[model samples]
Target: MHPVEDHGAPGSGGSRSAAGWLVLLALAGLAAFLLARPILTGPVAGLPAVAQSSSPYTVHRPAGGVRGGGIVNVDTELGYRGTLAAGTGIILDRDGLVLTNNHVIQGATALKATDTRTGRTFPAHVVGYDRSNDVAVIRLSGAKGAGLRPAAFGDSGKVSEGDAVTAKGNAGGKGGAPKIAQGRVTALEQTVIARDDSDGSSERLSGLIETDAAIRPGDSGGPLFNASGEVVGMDTAASAGFKMAKKGKGRGFAIPINRALGIAEQIRQGHGGAKIHIGRTAMLGVQVRPVDAGRTGSGGQSADGGQSGGQGGGQGGGAEVASTLPDTPADRLDVPTGAVITALDGEPVDSPNTLTDLLLRHHPGDRVALTYRMPGGQPVTQQITLASGPPQ
Candidate 1:
């Protein structure tokens, strides 16, 4: 199970169509879903390069060598299998504040960014994130005096269909100057259900701008600029199995810049809500799955030597621990693999999602009471401390 949230644009229809999977434009060797249990896999090699532009629209590198622009190449070290992922970001302030998609840094253990303008790399930290909206803000260390340039933002509400647009980013995760793909806005207020290829979990993103621009992997969170070179949207998901903009082919989606900025502002002010998480995530360091009805008790038998059911022996609804990470709080406290977590700090944890939500209300070093039940046994409560984990 994974943490899930409900979010949609105002006045947008409440219907979610089961469209085909929309690939998130983040460059990584293997597909990994946000908030899912980690699985080690072999590295995938030889990602294809972005298609060359043949349309009349321009594809040249930006003038002044990226130092004049507000984009940066973001690299993240994942918590699993030495995996590295790359994406793009837009500078929001001279102090290295950046706006990006939450999925770009979802499972990051460590993050670093390179300023295209000066070619300087700096360590970065997440300021806050709204996973429901797929928006995040990160601040670059040692960038206070670097004189970073901020991207010019335009009113997304004023944008009209058929308006000329250009999407720019690290096209192939090649990590240098940003690449540009020019096209026109084909639609607005579009909604799409994006599914994670790794886990089959789906999210509905509403009020997006649709374009034919050749937005590809490694372009996630890059700026979608209008004809005036002002950002009107943030490049996000793209249609799969389409060639890159040959004769105006392929489809891309972008979150409106105005809406993204609004989320960023809330993060900057340290405001947290049901959907917004401020600062680092607290980790229980355990992999879990929903408890199955059949195997709910000790040795697959109830206390009365019968199948476990309502009040027979097993906890009715809770997350079953599959495994615990070594040296983490869960392992340190000897949380049994076959036990079901029934509560956290006296609050009932009915499922994996409930457990995740309860943990989000805490921080590192906070000691809390954990309650779990062994197979066919009474609930046991233990005190444990939480540790800091990678971005969720």
Candidate 2:
């Protein structure tokens, strides 16, 4: 998964359409999805599939430098084949508080944040996340020697269609430098039903700013700046073409900076409790990977109810448990690794995203039933309470 943006299995080359604007988690390189050279084949299951180009983009060289002091490049490790999700963030406070999209940091085992101005990287900690709004905040844990420059805020409400603006981010998940693209705001108050390709989870985001500014995968959570260089929006999703491997052509939407910062403030204040997970996130306490190819259990049926991956042959299938967190729900139930999660709470589990998407549908302490089959065994159903923790 691009972790936060798209939820396709790693290295998947598939595309789905939505409302004339195909939605993807603005992740790069399904084969490399934003960052990390490929070590395997297949889409990033659990992350959504966005458009990708067989060719590298024409790298744009910013004349002066990365303009804003607050703009930070975000890199996340999604725990699969050294895969990563690359995006951008805006510094909200001099205390090192940074604002980004929830998907950008989702499922990250570790986060490395690099400030464009300081030219330095720092380990960051998740402050809080509002998955409903797709916004999140993190703090640069140990960047004392590096100066923190918060980006100047603009009133998104004051923004008008046709206004000229510039977008910036780690386009292509290419490292070291960030790329910039210029265009005009095309619309306002747009709504996109963005979905995770892997788990089939969707969120209806309203009151967004739409632009034709050439935003690309790996540009999610990046900044949309006005001519004054004031921050106005956070780039989120881009439209993908119908063909697999077709590149997105800059039709992108962003969460209004005002709304994003507002939600981020609540997270910092520790409000909304579990409804808005703070610091650590809620989890089901299980680690899983897609079941192997050509492997069949009882009745010669795959956990996904069919062959692993569809006819296109991507990494689509039910997840095989890899491990369980100690003292957590799965552990308490003695959920053994290698068991295939075929269903959860009666819903079919087609991919790892299915498990996560279903889990996100409930709150901490909520109980849900799981249907699984031990390696080479028959299916078994068990109920387990959910648990809360940081992204591992």
Candidate 3:
């Protein structure tokens, strides 16, 4: 045919097309190598590190980092900024009243809680607290319809150290998300000292489980689970260092769930379906830092300051008073929200810590006179009986 002798093969156009594809493939391969250089070299080349460069294993966590069960690596985040909304809680009764650590709500007074997996949020209220036990009960508004999911409680007495344990918490809120951790109980009946940063005092606690699983601040009040998914303890405090204890901030502690259930009973029966037992009233619910010469509230805690912190005259706390129960002693005496309580029962009230200490000496349904400033700008003296709700 036309150039049969000179043409190397038939369908020369096909050969040209194949050659073009080969060129394209080479170019693509080169581009891929160029773009992937970072991931390939930093770790593969054994160079130092840059952000986002790591080996096949292990990730990074900052001071705010959060994770779940077993160091097995689930979702991660920077830290807690009050973003978490819901976690596994105990359903103690048919009334749909749930029990959790008061701190889980962080004194929100009211909140929206949703199941981590279901994405359902419901309105919740602080029902009560038995302070000495640090257990709080919350009543879910319209719990039946709010997709309320209740967790079962495992007997702390039944749990032994070195047993497998699981911890679940809403660490990042939307970012940290929900995570689980797997660990063995390293220590049982461990004595831990906890400092309420709000008041700046330390608490010596016993009967706490020591685990190797990572725990964070927001994890407080969350449920510590067992292999069968039963709760053993309420995540309370991480083992931290004081001037006295040099241990780093890694050990996490939980109030025994069985203990929490006992205190929850009082709160479930008392004031308007909410029982508040004042066990310890010495701790204030605010954190303070030296501000502009005098002092100011550093963390979201009250700026008014309280006696629980490192050093204070007696007591001072700066949490916003949302409101008082109606017809109750506090309400009857006209103790209104927005009043910064500087003292209670003649004790200088600065933080919830001081109040907690005072309450410790009293019983539920006991009446105490409180002097407070009126929101309308008046310093008033009034005596109000303290009605009990739940254990703090």
Candidate 4:
């Protein structure tokens, strides 16, 4: 009631109080802006890119070093644990198709894949396996099945030795994230043998990229990345006779990831145990019809399939000599039928395909000689000229 009469000046204490509040509010707004600047810049990177999925890899490391860890974990978005070993896997589909190694999940009774950051583990069911290639695809079920982080893949053939490389995979144990390794490739067109003694089976991996980057068993089934971080190969084995890679012994092997991808896709699409075409490669000119086992003879012993006209499994004798054809690369040299050439460039040649694969490494015009034994066991030397196909 007294305000009208008691007011000292027109806009005195009330105005001052209002101005103070305005200044405080303005300062508070600026403080708020500064606090949220980092968040406002963009979405935080540590979180998974896919809306609600857990990140596949971790951004932080223990401060020593990491090569492809971040890329594998962040990009592949899946990790696996199994009997052969624990490794990383790629999510090939939005519905949770994981591509891993046959050896990784081979003969495993149970499997559990978890996002290292989420503590959420998904039970993975083995969909199918290809023993020929040592590759497998896994399907995740239940809550962790959706919102997967799929990696980008590329043509592996385009990658060449000496190109910069990155690898993503699980290292250590279940707590591990996709670790990184980087180096120039040491070799290509690699051939490594994997033997399953338990089943008396042997398999070979060819067309592989061998690198000096150090990797471990846990790295099997992981992805080998290019500079762009796109997966180019599937991390598989160490170099031939390379049991383990330690410091200063940089060496690792990766299968062309493209092949694994193709197989995995087919398995996901409902073709189980499907034989992959891998594109048949021809090596020699002589095309021997599958000679019947009982009808033909090789090393004087035969099987139901056939004589295996090439080298029979037993004791190594010579480089392979197929049934001769008229005017072909072999016939051009007058290679006598039943002449078994044992070695090429000082190594025992086992299969005709391997020899052909080796020959392809040389130019069509290159000169290749043979060391073989004729029917009488007399050694014969023939300097043979190479050609594209079975010489006419």
Candidate 5:
């Protein structure tokens, strides 16, 4: 979903001023046009551009004979926030059903998919999302030409450490042609926390296939192929650096193709499982801003000389409540604006994203405990049932 950091730009919650909105717009432009495409930006016009550095992998070869008809370049618009996000997808059926990471299409208003083989683009739409599994499905009803080529799937169960593999995607977010990177299966049944450094949202992922392949930004949801050219996994996340690489070679992660296809089948059949959010997001109905830096445990005092509530025993940083949706969980719990959220379910709230990341672990209709305090007051804890959120 990213190069070194996640896609999209970090969003601020505290203020709703016009200038704030403008800043967000600028960030959106930078993310979509600059970062997404890996192109030069302001003050660099007419300058010679440099090529991407080689992957830090060895014992690899070009994926020349690998089939790429099923790979698609995925792009989505974060509607309300005016940002564009990019990733990759694999065609699952002749009718253009696509499988991708949930984060790829989340909060999307407009979706466009580009076929790797034909270079044809199609308007795509979300079918469903499994936030817990970080998987999603989209349909491309209007794809041009003779439809799509479904990828041949292999048994992920057959994968073993040291197995040969190749990865493909729209590396660098360039949608024209998918890039190829080769490596070997380094581990299996891996568990990780896939994080979005931009927005601070993170997902706990498990049962993953780990590889030393060079997965890049815009590669999320792309295919990981075995030596026989069959899809064995779906490229998902990559480590920022290789702990074992003296030169810092990084590793990549993927969802087993078997697991990915199972979820896709359920989504196509309209199965709304307990962990799946169909066409909606699970939300707590509160807007918050990150606590200012250099503040003590009490978040100090508000700039207006008003009390800002105690910081309590939360982590490094915490979120200051800006507002709560009327009739929602936070409002029902009487979580007043300006209160600082210190913890959730006993876990410290280090930042706005930390709260968001933790809340995403639960689904709609789930109940969570929150700890907070009003300005200059002691901490208070309450149990609140989350509600289905509006489409972003």
Candidate 6:
């Protein structure tokens, strides 16, 4: 989730940090605040101010018009500092169903897309996501019968090494006409580990189509067109420092379109599995960190340096609360900072990741018991109603 540097133009080449090479094709200024610990060292006045927009739905279109069937410039408003991130997507249906990478819309508070074909912008909502596979499906708001043109699909199984391909996307996050890069497929069924520098989280992606195309940032979720002008894959990760057979070109990877479409179909049918989450995510509204083992519950002090009062010892393992969002279920219940969340319902919560996985199993309006322990206190359980949260 490293914020992409704003080049402000297409094909403006730039060198990336060491971490950048591990993950590419993410959005500019993209940050997942919920997945990482927030900075609490400074006062609000010390932070730089970002101007707020009067209208959240307004999209800033580039000067030149773009042409393509069902391709779109996806814009996401993050939860932090009014920052806007951009990526690409492909239309799956005439009613504005779009397929994109999960990382493109991850941590987005608001979403909108400009169709490259029609040059029309529309608000959008997530239908479902397979976070492990990095695939997501979203539908345009009020576009059930919009008659949008869908991208041409090809059989990925028929693809082979040395095939000529074209990658098109909003390169460098400059939202004008889609940038085009031509190259030959170098390999098939390749695997790579994509890491998010912002949070140090990583996921393994396999069965990828490797190419020498320059798939830059903002090119994510765009189409990898074969010689026949049919999409064989979705543009995904690109290596910045890695060497390729073609010395001047960068190495790019794409998820096979056949696999992506299969997952998209599962999402469209509202099928939720271990790796796929359907609809909106449920929120506990509390930012947490791993509990420090050195800091045992004593002297009425919580694990996160907050004050608390109780008569018992600390729990060995749990997620320590760093802060709670206002008007959230955790806030309404007075779940104090530094408190250790030991469990959700009856499942043990050892870390923030575990807590997230447990919460994903439920949806908004679901009532579940939350178990926690204050500093120097015994375990306490309370029933809290979950609320709707931003897409994960």
**Per-prediction CA RMSD (Å):** 12.2, 11.3, 23.0, 29.0, 11.3, 12.5
Candidate 6, lDDT over the whole model: 0.67
Ranking by lDDT: 1, 6, 5, 2, 4, 3
Instruction: Candidate 5: list runs displaced more than 4 Å.
Output: 2-68, 144-146, 196-202, 241-248, 282-286, 289-320, 323-392
TM-score of each: 0.76, 0.64, 0.52, 0.48, 0.62, 0.76
Segments of candidate 6 deviating more than 4 angstroms: 1-68, 144-147, 240-249, 293-314
Candidate 6, position 320, lDDT: 70
Segments in model 2 whose C-alpha atoms lie over 4 Å from true places: 1-67, 80-82, 196-201, 242-249, 273-275, 287-332, 336-392
| Candidate 1 runs further than 4 Å off | 1-68, 243-247, 292-316
Winner of 2 and 4 under lDDT: 2
| Candidate 4 local distance difference test against the native | 0.47
Two-way lDDT contest, 1 vs 3, winner: 1
Assess the local accuracy of residue 234 in candidate 1 as a C-alpha lDDT between 0 and 100.
Answer: 88
Q: How far is candidate 5 from the true structure (C-alpha RMSD, Å)?
A: 11.3
The predicted structure with the larger TM-score, 2 or 4, is: 2
| Model 4: CA > 4 A from native | 1-85, 116-119, 143-146, 196-201, 240-248, 273-392
Q: Write the per-residue lDDT of candidate 2 for residues 1-392, one digit (tens) a residue.
A: 13233344553322322111101111212222232111121112332122111111121112232345468889886543234467788887666788888867765667888988768888998887876677888989876546777787766667887888888887766655668888888777776665444433345666667787877777778889988887778888765531122333436777777777677778777665433666654567776655666666554654433223332212235666767766777878898877877777787776554555555556567778888877657668898777764442
- Per residue, candidate 6 scores C-alpha lDDT tens digits across 1-392 of 22333355332222222211101111211242112111122112322122112221122211221233458888776542234567889888778789988878776778888877667888999999887677899989877666567787777777887888998887666676778888888877776666545544455676778788877667888889888878888887777443233554567888887778888888887889888899988888877656664586764544432212122223566677777777888889998877788788888776655676678788999999999887656678999999877766
State model 1's lDDT.
0.68
Q: Residue 151's C-alpha lDDT in candidate 5?
A: 76
The number of residue pairs in model 6 that clash at the backbone is: 0
Tell me which of candidates 1 and 2 scores higher on lDDT: 1
Better of 5 and 6 by TM-score: 6
